[model samples]
Target chain A: AQKVTQAQTEISVVEKEDVTLDCVYETRDTTYYLFWYKQPPSGELVFLIRRNSFDEQNEISGRYSWNFQKSTSSFNFTITASQVVDSAVYFCALSGEVVFGAGTILRVKS
Target chain B: DARVTQTPRHKVTEMGQEVTMRCQPILGHNTVFWYRQTMMQGLELLAYFRNRAPLDDSGMPKDRFSAEMPDATLATLKIQPSEPRDSAVYFCASGSGTDQGGYTFGSGTRLTVV
Candidate 1:
Protein backbone atom coordinates (compact mmCIF):
# COMPACT_ATOMS: atom_id res chain seq x y z
CA ALA A 1 0.00 0.00 0.00
CA GLN A 2 1.17 3.54 -0.79
CA LYS A 3 1.44 6.15 1.91
CA VAL A 4 1.74 9.93 1.95
CA THR A 5 3.39 11.82 4.79
CA GLN A 6 3.04 15.53 5.48
CA ALA A 7 5.08 16.41 8.47
CA GLN A 8 3.82 19.94 8.78
CA THR A 9 0.71 20.06 10.95
CA GLU A 10 0.13 23.81 10.75
CA ILE A 11 1.67 26.80 9.04
CA SER A 12 1.02 30.48 9.67
CA VAL A 13 2.29 33.35 7.56
CA VAL A 14 1.31 36.96 7.12
CA GLU A 15 -0.28 37.98 3.90
CA LYS A 16 2.15 38.57 1.03
CA GLU A 17 4.63 36.12 2.45
CA ASP A 18 5.77 33.00 0.67
CA VAL A 19 5.03 29.59 2.13
CA THR A 20 6.10 26.07 1.33
CA LEU A 21 4.47 22.79 2.33
CA ASP A 22 6.54 19.63 2.29
CA CYS A 23 5.18 16.24 1.26
CA VAL A 24 6.82 12.84 1.02
CA TYR A 25 5.33 9.63 -0.27
CA GLU A 26 6.22 5.94 -0.33
CA THR A 27 5.05 3.68 -3.11
CA ARG A 28 6.25 0.60 -4.95
CA ASP A 29 5.03 1.66 -8.36
CA THR A 30 7.57 3.39 -10.52
CA THR A 31 4.94 5.18 -12.56
CA TYR A 32 2.23 7.05 -10.71
CA TYR A 33 0.70 10.51 -10.27
CA LEU A 34 0.95 13.27 -7.68
CA PHE A 35 -1.59 15.96 -6.84
CA TRP A 36 -2.15 18.97 -4.59
CA TYR A 37 -5.61 19.92 -3.44
CA LYS A 38 -6.90 22.92 -1.49
CA GLN A 39 -9.87 22.75 0.86
CA PRO A 40 -11.22 26.06 2.04
CA PRO A 41 -13.74 26.69 4.81
CA SER A 42 -16.50 26.24 2.25
CA GLY A 43 -15.99 22.49 2.53
CA GLU A 44 -15.02 21.85 -1.07
CA LEU A 45 -11.87 20.18 -2.22
CA VAL A 46 -10.28 22.17 -5.03
CA PHE A 47 -7.66 20.74 -7.39
CA LEU A 48 -4.48 22.71 -7.47
CA ILE A 49 -1.89 20.86 -9.52
CA ARG A 50 -1.03 17.41 -10.89
CA ARG A 51 2.30 15.93 -11.88
CA ASN A 52 3.04 12.59 -13.42
CA SER A 53 5.90 10.43 -12.24
CA PHE A 54 7.71 10.57 -15.58
CA ASP A 55 7.52 14.36 -15.63
CA GLU A 56 10.20 15.75 -13.41
CA GLN A 57 9.85 19.28 -14.63
CA ASN A 58 8.81 21.82 -12.01
CA GLU A 59 5.54 23.52 -12.86
CA ILE A 60 4.39 27.07 -12.13
CA SER A 61 0.89 28.47 -12.36
CA GLY A 62 0.56 32.12 -11.45
CA ARG A 63 1.62 32.43 -7.82
CA TYR A 64 1.64 28.67 -7.17
CA SER A 65 4.39 26.19 -8.04
CA TRP A 66 5.17 22.54 -7.38
CA ASN A 67 8.48 20.73 -7.27
CA PHE A 68 8.47 17.02 -7.97
CA GLN A 69 11.65 15.19 -7.09
CA LYS A 70 11.60 11.45 -7.59
CA SER A 71 14.90 10.92 -5.80
CA THR A 72 13.66 12.28 -2.47
CA SER A 73 10.14 11.02 -3.03
CA SER A 74 8.95 14.57 -2.45
CA PHE A 75 6.42 16.82 -4.14
CA ASN A 76 6.43 20.21 -2.49
CA PHE A 77 4.13 23.16 -3.07
CA THR A 78 5.08 26.81 -2.80
CA ILE A 79 2.88 29.86 -2.74
CA THR A 80 4.34 33.24 -3.60
CA ALA A 81 2.88 36.24 -1.83
CA SER A 82 0.00 34.23 -0.56
CA GLN A 83 -3.27 36.00 0.18
CA VAL A 84 -5.87 35.41 2.86
CA VAL A 85 -7.87 33.39 0.39
CA ASP A 86 -4.98 30.97 0.28
CA SER A 87 -5.66 30.00 3.86
CA ALA A 88 -6.89 26.44 3.86
CA VAL A 89 -5.92 22.82 4.35
CA TYR A 90 -3.65 21.62 1.55
CA PHE A 91 -3.49 17.94 0.78
CA CYS A 92 -0.78 16.11 -1.15
CA ALA A 93 -1.83 12.89 -2.80
CA LEU A 94 -0.13 10.02 -4.59
CA SER A 95 -2.38 8.45 -7.17
CA GLY A 96 -1.33 5.00 -8.07
CA GLU A 97 -4.56 4.28 -6.29
CA VAL A 98 -5.12 7.80 -4.89
CA VAL A 99 -3.47 7.81 -1.48
CA PHE A 100 -3.62 11.16 0.38
CA GLY A 101 -1.41 12.73 2.98
CA ALA A 102 -2.56 13.82 6.40
CA GLY A 103 -2.80 17.39 5.04
CA THR A 104 -1.21 20.65 6.18
CA ILE A 105 -3.25 23.49 7.58
CA LEU A 106 -2.22 26.91 6.25
CA ARG A 107 -3.23 30.22 7.70
CA VAL A 108 -2.46 33.45 5.89
CA LYS A 109 -2.96 36.34 8.19
CA SER A 110 -3.61 39.90 7.15
CA ASP B 1 -18.28 23.52 -16.27
CA ALA B 2 -18.53 19.85 -15.45
CA ARG B 3 -18.46 19.08 -11.75
CA VAL B 4 -19.39 16.27 -9.40
CA THR B 5 -22.64 16.98 -7.54
CA GLN B 6 -23.50 15.70 -4.06
CA THR B 7 -26.85 16.10 -2.41
CA PRO B 8 -27.87 16.91 1.16
CA ARG B 9 -24.97 19.26 1.75
CA HIS B 10 -25.72 19.18 5.46
CA LYS B 11 -27.37 16.39 7.41
CA VAL B 12 -28.03 16.29 11.13
CA THR B 13 -29.39 13.00 12.37
CA GLU B 14 -29.84 11.22 15.65
CA MET B 15 -27.65 8.30 16.54
CA GLY B 16 -28.91 4.89 15.36
CA GLN B 17 -30.67 6.56 12.43
CA GLU B 18 -29.86 5.64 8.85
CA VAL B 19 -28.01 8.20 6.77
CA THR B 20 -27.78 8.14 3.02
CA MET B 21 -25.68 10.51 0.93
CA ARG B 22 -25.83 10.75 -2.84
CA CYS B 23 -23.33 11.74 -5.48
CA GLN B 24 -23.66 12.48 -9.17
CA PRO B 25 -20.46 12.09 -11.09
CA ILE B 26 -19.57 14.30 -13.97
CA LEU B 27 -20.89 13.24 -17.32
CA GLY B 28 -18.65 10.85 -19.26
CA HIS B 29 -16.49 10.14 -16.23
CA ASN B 30 -16.18 6.44 -15.61
CA THR B 31 -14.74 6.37 -12.10
CA VAL B 32 -16.20 7.47 -8.79
CA PHE B 33 -14.84 7.53 -5.26
CA TRP B 34 -16.26 8.03 -1.76
CA TYR B 35 -14.24 9.63 0.98
CA ARG B 36 -14.73 10.51 4.64
CA GLN B 37 -12.97 13.40 6.33
CA THR B 38 -12.48 14.28 9.97
CA MET B 39 -10.05 16.33 11.99
CA MET B 40 -8.51 13.24 13.50
CA GLN B 41 -8.50 10.90 10.49
CA GLY B 42 -8.02 13.61 7.85
CA LEU B 43 -9.15 12.00 4.59
CA GLU B 44 -9.92 8.36 3.97
CA LEU B 45 -11.11 6.63 0.83
CA LEU B 46 -14.17 4.66 1.74
CA ALA B 47 -15.03 3.06 -1.59
CA TYR B 48 -14.10 3.18 -5.25
CA PHE B 49 -16.22 2.30 -8.28
CA ARG B 50 -15.74 2.23 -12.01
CA ASN B 51 -18.46 2.00 -14.59
CA ARG B 52 -20.98 1.41 -11.84
CA ALA B 53 -18.99 -1.56 -10.53
CA PRO B 54 -17.33 -1.56 -7.14
CA LEU B 55 -13.60 -2.11 -7.29
CA ASP B 56 -12.58 -1.62 -3.67
CA ASP B 57 -14.31 -0.83 -0.40
CA SER B 58 -11.92 -2.08 2.20
CA GLY B 59 -11.77 1.33 3.82
CA MET B 60 -15.46 1.22 4.63
CA PRO B 61 -16.86 -0.17 7.87
CA LYS B 62 -18.53 -3.36 6.69
CA ASP B 63 -21.17 -3.64 9.39
CA ARG B 64 -22.76 -0.21 9.34
CA PHE B 65 -21.50 1.23 6.06
CA SER B 66 -22.50 0.35 2.51
CA ALA B 67 -21.75 1.91 -0.89
CA GLU B 68 -23.28 1.28 -4.30
CA MET B 69 -23.47 2.73 -7.76
CA PRO B 70 -26.76 1.72 -9.24
CA ASP B 71 -25.93 3.55 -12.47
CA ALA B 72 -23.04 5.37 -14.06
CA THR B 73 -24.02 8.76 -12.70
CA LEU B 74 -25.39 7.95 -9.28
CA ALA B 75 -23.48 6.72 -6.23
CA THR B 76 -24.82 6.29 -2.76
CA LEU B 77 -23.27 5.72 0.65
CA LYS B 78 -25.44 4.56 3.48
CA ILE B 79 -24.60 4.20 7.12
CA GLN B 80 -26.99 2.22 9.27
CA PRO B 81 -27.41 2.85 12.98
CA SER B 82 -25.07 5.75 12.82
CA GLU B 83 -23.03 6.67 15.82
CA PRO B 84 -21.65 10.00 16.95
CA ARG B 85 -18.27 8.91 15.63
CA ASP B 86 -19.77 9.11 12.15
CA SER B 87 -20.05 12.87 12.38
CA ALA B 88 -17.83 14.23 9.65
CA VAL B 89 -17.80 15.51 6.12
CA TYR B 90 -18.22 12.90 3.39
CA PHE B 91 -16.92 13.72 -0.05
CA CYS B 92 -17.50 12.19 -3.47
CA ALA B 93 -15.07 12.56 -6.33
CA SER B 94 -15.00 11.53 -9.97
CA GLY B 95 -12.52 11.34 -12.78
CA SER B 96 -11.93 9.71 -16.10
CA GLY B 97 -10.90 6.11 -15.61
CA THR B 98 -8.14 6.57 -18.13
CA ASP B 99 -6.82 9.66 -16.39
CA GLN B 100 -4.71 8.95 -13.37
CA GLY B 101 -3.74 12.54 -12.79
CA GLY B 102 -6.62 14.19 -10.90
CA TYR B 103 -10.16 13.79 -9.66
CA THR B 104 -12.88 16.45 -9.36
CA PHE B 105 -14.49 16.48 -5.93
CA GLY B 106 -17.98 17.38 -4.92
CA SER B 107 -18.96 19.91 -2.26
CA GLY B 108 -19.31 17.09 0.30
CA THR B 109 -22.06 16.27 2.73
CA ARG B 110 -21.52 17.36 6.31
CA LEU B 111 -23.07 14.74 8.58
CA THR B 112 -23.67 15.51 12.22
CA VAL B 113 -24.76 12.45 14.17
CA VAL B 114 -26.04 13.77 17.45
Candidate 2:
Protein backbone atom coordinates (compact mmCIF):
# COMPACT_ATOMS: atom_id res chain seq x y z
CA ALA A 1 0.00 0.00 0.00
CA GLN A 2 1.12 3.56 -0.80
CA LYS A 3 0.65 6.22 1.81
CA VAL A 4 1.53 9.90 2.25
CA THR A 5 1.58 11.54 5.64
CA GLN A 6 1.47 15.26 6.39
CA ALA A 7 1.87 15.38 10.13
CA GLN A 8 0.89 18.98 10.53
CA THR A 9 -2.86 19.41 10.32
CA GLU A 10 -2.65 23.20 10.53
CA ILE A 11 0.00 25.87 10.87
CA SER A 12 -0.35 29.59 11.49
CA VAL A 13 2.43 32.06 10.72
CA VAL A 14 2.73 35.80 10.60
CA GLU A 15 3.58 37.58 7.41
CA LYS A 16 7.22 37.44 6.33
CA GLU A 17 7.72 34.46 8.62
CA ASP A 18 9.11 31.27 7.15
CA VAL A 19 7.25 27.99 7.44
CA THR A 20 8.01 24.48 6.43
CA LEU A 21 5.52 21.68 5.77
CA ASP A 22 6.73 18.14 6.28
CA CYS A 23 5.70 15.23 4.05
CA VAL A 24 6.65 11.57 4.37
CA TYR A 25 5.68 8.81 2.01
CA GLU A 26 5.78 5.00 1.92
CA THR A 27 5.91 2.96 -1.27
CA ARG A 28 7.32 -0.37 -2.31
CA ASP A 29 8.13 0.64 -5.86
CA THR A 30 11.71 1.65 -6.51
CA THR A 31 10.60 4.11 -9.20
CA TYR A 32 7.83 6.52 -8.28
CA TYR A 33 7.00 10.20 -8.15
CA LEU A 34 6.13 12.75 -5.49
CA PHE A 35 4.08 15.91 -5.92
CA TRP A 36 2.88 18.94 -4.00
CA TYR A 37 -0.34 20.84 -4.63
CA LYS A 38 -1.88 23.96 -3.15
CA GLN A 39 -5.60 24.55 -2.80
CA PRO A 40 -6.63 28.09 -2.10
CA PRO A 41 -10.02 29.29 -0.86
CA SER A 42 -11.21 29.26 -4.43
CA GLY A 43 -11.37 25.46 -4.23
CA GLU A 44 -9.02 24.84 -7.12
CA LEU A 45 -5.89 22.77 -6.73
CA VAL A 46 -2.68 24.32 -8.05
CA PHE A 47 0.22 22.07 -8.89
CA LEU A 48 3.46 23.14 -7.24
CA ILE A 49 6.20 20.63 -8.03
CA ARG A 50 6.84 17.04 -9.06
CA ARG A 51 9.95 15.06 -8.22
CA ASN A 52 10.88 11.62 -9.44
CA SER A 53 12.47 9.00 -7.20
CA PHE A 54 15.73 8.83 -9.18
CA ASP A 55 16.24 12.61 -8.96
CA GLU A 56 16.88 13.61 -5.39
CA GLN A 57 17.91 17.16 -6.22
CA ASN A 58 16.30 19.88 -4.11
CA GLU A 59 14.24 22.46 -5.97
CA ILE A 60 13.68 26.12 -5.28
CA SER A 61 11.13 28.46 -6.86
CA GLY A 62 11.23 32.03 -5.65
CA ARG A 63 10.12 32.09 -2.01
CA TYR A 64 9.12 28.41 -2.22
CA SER A 65 11.59 25.55 -2.04
CA TRP A 66 11.42 21.77 -1.69
CA ASN A 67 13.87 19.40 -0.06
CA PHE A 68 13.56 15.78 -1.11
CA GLN A 69 15.65 13.23 0.76
CA LYS A 70 15.36 9.62 -0.26
CA SER A 71 17.39 8.60 2.78
CA THR A 72 14.62 9.90 5.04
CA SER A 73 11.76 9.28 2.63
CA SER A 74 10.74 12.82 3.23
CA PHE A 75 9.81 15.72 0.92
CA ASN A 76 9.57 18.99 2.76
CA PHE A 77 8.24 22.31 1.43
CA THR A 78 9.46 25.64 2.74
CA ILE A 79 8.13 29.10 2.22
CA THR A 80 10.79 31.77 2.71
CA ALA A 81 8.50 34.73 3.35
CA SER A 82 4.95 33.69 3.75
CA GLN A 83 2.25 36.21 2.91
CA VAL A 84 -1.49 36.36 3.45
CA VAL A 85 -1.94 35.28 -0.14
CA ASP A 86 -0.05 32.11 0.62
CA SER A 87 -2.68 30.94 3.09
CA ALA A 88 -4.13 27.70 1.80
CA VAL A 89 -4.19 23.93 2.15
CA TYR A 90 -1.16 22.09 0.85
CA PHE A 91 -1.23 18.44 -0.10
CA CYS A 92 1.61 16.00 -0.58
CA ALA A 93 1.00 13.07 -2.87
CA LEU A 94 2.76 9.93 -4.00
CA SER A 95 2.39 8.27 -7.38
CA GLY A 96 1.41 4.66 -8.21
CA GLU A 97 -2.13 4.97 -6.87
CA VAL A 98 -1.68 8.72 -6.39
CA VAL A 99 -2.17 8.62 -2.66
CA PHE A 100 -2.63 12.08 -1.11
CA GLY A 101 -1.87 13.29 2.35
CA ALA A 102 -4.45 14.58 4.79
CA GLY A 103 -3.32 18.10 3.81
CA THR A 104 -1.97 20.89 5.97
CA ILE A 105 -4.00 24.06 6.36
CA LEU A 106 -1.66 27.04 6.36
CA ARG A 107 -2.79 30.41 7.65
CA VAL A 108 -0.46 33.30 6.88
CA LYS A 109 -1.60 36.32 8.84
CA SER A 110 -0.66 39.80 7.85
CA ASP B 1 -3.13 26.95 -21.18
CA ALA B 2 -5.81 24.37 -21.75
CA ARG B 3 -7.62 23.32 -18.57
CA VAL B 4 -10.19 20.84 -17.26
CA THR B 5 -13.76 22.12 -17.05
CA GLN B 6 -16.47 20.86 -14.68
CA THR B 7 -20.13 21.75 -14.67
CA PRO B 8 -22.47 22.78 -11.83
CA ARG B 9 -19.88 24.50 -9.72
CA HIS B 10 -22.14 23.86 -6.76
CA LYS B 11 -25.01 21.49 -6.06
CA VAL B 12 -27.42 21.08 -3.19
CA THR B 13 -29.53 17.95 -3.06
CA GLU B 14 -31.64 16.17 -0.51
CA MET B 15 -30.53 12.90 0.97
CA GLY B 16 -31.33 9.88 -1.19
CA GLN B 17 -31.55 12.07 -4.28
CA GLU B 18 -29.51 11.20 -7.32
CA VAL B 19 -26.72 13.54 -8.32
CA THR B 20 -24.56 13.65 -11.40
CA MET B 21 -21.38 15.65 -11.88
CA ARG B 22 -19.77 16.25 -15.23
CA CYS B 23 -16.20 16.89 -16.33
CA GLN B 24 -14.54 17.89 -19.56
CA PRO B 25 -10.87 17.09 -19.59
CA ILE B 26 -8.24 19.13 -21.37
CA LEU B 27 -8.03 18.62 -25.06
CA GLY B 28 -5.73 15.82 -26.21
CA HIS B 29 -5.32 14.52 -22.68
CA ASN B 30 -6.02 10.81 -22.47
CA THR B 31 -6.34 10.46 -18.71
CA VAL B 32 -9.12 11.72 -16.46
CA PHE B 33 -9.37 11.40 -12.71
CA TRP B 34 -12.20 12.00 -10.27
CA TYR B 35 -11.52 12.91 -6.66
CA ARG B 36 -13.61 13.71 -3.62
CA GLN B 37 -12.50 16.07 -0.88
CA THR B 38 -13.92 16.30 2.62
CA MET B 39 -12.70 17.47 5.98
CA MET B 40 -12.48 13.95 7.34
CA GLN B 41 -11.03 12.12 4.32
CA GLY B 42 -9.20 15.03 2.70
CA LEU B 43 -8.72 13.99 -0.92
CA GLU B 44 -9.89 10.58 -2.10
CA LEU B 45 -9.64 9.17 -5.58
CA LEU B 46 -13.05 7.92 -6.63
CA ALA B 47 -12.11 6.65 -10.05
CA TYR B 48 -10.10 7.33 -13.20
CA PHE B 49 -10.10 6.65 -16.91
CA ARG B 50 -7.31 6.09 -19.40
CA ASN B 51 -7.89 6.52 -23.10
CA ARG B 52 -11.62 6.82 -22.30
CA ALA B 53 -11.64 3.39 -20.72
CA PRO B 54 -12.23 2.73 -17.04
CA LEU B 55 -8.94 1.90 -15.38
CA ASP B 56 -9.45 1.83 -11.62
CA ASP B 57 -12.64 2.50 -9.68
CA SER B 58 -11.89 0.41 -6.67
CA GLY B 59 -11.87 3.54 -4.58
CA MET B 60 -15.53 4.27 -5.35
CA PRO B 61 -18.53 2.83 -3.54
CA LYS B 62 -19.78 0.15 -5.85
CA ASP B 63 -23.36 0.25 -4.57
CA ARG B 64 -23.99 3.99 -4.85
CA PHE B 65 -21.31 5.56 -7.02
CA SER B 66 -20.65 5.01 -10.70
CA ALA B 67 -18.10 6.72 -12.94
CA GLU B 68 -17.99 6.58 -16.69
CA MET B 69 -16.41 8.25 -19.67
CA PRO B 70 -19.00 8.10 -22.40
CA ASP B 71 -16.59 9.81 -24.78
CA ALA B 72 -13.14 11.33 -24.82
CA THR B 73 -14.37 14.82 -24.06
CA LEU B 74 -16.72 13.96 -21.21
CA ALA B 75 -16.69 12.07 -17.92
CA THR B 76 -19.49 11.66 -15.45
CA LEU B 77 -19.85 10.53 -11.83
CA LYS B 78 -23.29 9.55 -10.62
CA ILE B 79 -24.59 8.78 -7.18
CA GLN B 80 -27.80 6.81 -7.20
CA PRO B 81 -28.72 7.66 -3.64
CA SER B 82 -26.41 10.24 -2.20
CA GLU B 83 -26.18 10.42 1.56
CA PRO B 84 -25.17 13.26 3.86
CA ARG B 85 -21.76 11.66 4.16
CA ASP B 86 -21.34 12.05 0.43
CA SER B 87 -21.22 15.80 0.69
CA ALA B 88 -17.87 17.01 -0.48
CA VAL B 89 -16.04 18.81 -3.25
CA TYR B 90 -15.74 16.69 -6.38
CA PHE B 91 -12.66 17.47 -8.45
CA CYS B 92 -11.81 16.42 -11.97
CA ALA B 93 -8.27 16.36 -13.24
CA SER B 94 -6.66 15.55 -16.55
CA GLY B 95 -3.23 14.45 -17.66
CA SER B 96 -1.59 13.28 -20.85
CA GLY B 97 -0.45 9.86 -19.79
CA THR B 98 0.45 7.68 -16.83
CA ASP B 99 3.89 9.26 -16.68
CA GLN B 100 2.52 12.78 -16.52
CA GLY B 101 3.82 14.09 -13.24
CA GLY B 102 1.18 16.71 -12.58
CA TYR B 103 -2.47 16.89 -13.56
CA THR B 104 -4.56 19.94 -14.39
CA PHE B 105 -7.50 20.12 -12.00
CA GLY B 106 -10.87 21.76 -12.51
CA SER B 107 -12.49 24.21 -10.13
CA GLY B 108 -14.43 21.29 -8.65
CA THR B 109 -18.11 20.77 -7.84
CA ARG B 110 -19.15 21.50 -4.31
CA LEU B 111 -21.86 18.94 -3.55
CA THR B 112 -24.00 19.28 -0.47
CA VAL B 113 -26.29 16.42 0.47
CA VAL B 114 -28.68 17.47 3.17
What is the docking quality class of candidate 1?
A: high
**Backbone collision count in every prediction?**
0, 0
Runs of candidate 2 exceeding 4 Å displacement: none
Query: What tens-digit string does per-residue lDDT give for candidate 2 at A3-105?
Result: 9999999999999999999999999999999999999998899999999999999999999999999999999999999999999999999986578999999
Model 2 residue A57 distance off true place after TM-score fit, in angstroms: 0.6
Give the alpha carbon lDDT tens digit for every residue of A70-98 in model 1: 99999999999999999999999988558
Which segments of candidate 1 are over 4 A away from where they belong? none
- List clashing residue pairs in candidate 1: none
Best by TM-score: 1
